[model samples]
Target: MIRLDYPIVIEPAPEEEGGGYRARVPDLPGCISDGETRQEAVSNIQQAIMAWLAEARNLGWSVPSA
Candidate 1:
């Protein structure tokens, strides 16, 4: 498995519901993950990025240059 070692930035957004944190990675389009807590949101984003990269590689898509 080819692993990509890069950095991802996560920013907090105002929650539409009662309360929570929203995370988004600018470098990865449509790559947004959120959770009730800031820590959780960031952690989920990392998992999301890993999955995205794996799927992209499997589909023979060009991995976005960070």
Candidate 2:
């Protein structure tokens, strides 16, 4: 299996925003996920990365390297 690593930025949700975590992959443009905890956010982001790669492949889009 080809593994791709991308830098992710995880930010805390503002208190007004309900208090959770959000993770975003900068290289994947719009590839993001969120959850109620840091662990969940990271896990969700990993799933997002997989989905993003799959969609990119389906559309014949270029996949960037880590």
Instruction: Please name the candidate that would achieve the greatest lDDT relative to the true structure.
Output: 2
Candidate 1 has its poorest 10 consecutive residues by lDDT at: 1-10
Give the range where candidate 2 is weakest over 10 consecutive residues by summed lDDT: 1-10
Expressed as tens digits, the lDDT of each residue in 1-66 for candidate 2 is 546589989999887988899999999999999999999999999999999999999999999987
Candidate with maximal TM-score:
2
RMSD of each: 2.4, 1.1
Estimate the TM-score for candidate 2.
0.91
In candidate 1, stretches whose alpha carbon ends up further than 4 angstroms from where it belongs are 1-15
Please provide, for model 1 over 1-66, each residue's C-alpha lDDT reduced to its tens digit, 9 standing for 90 to 100: 544445556555665564677777776677778887889887888788888878888989888876
Candidate 2 wrongly placed segments (more than 4 Å): 2-4
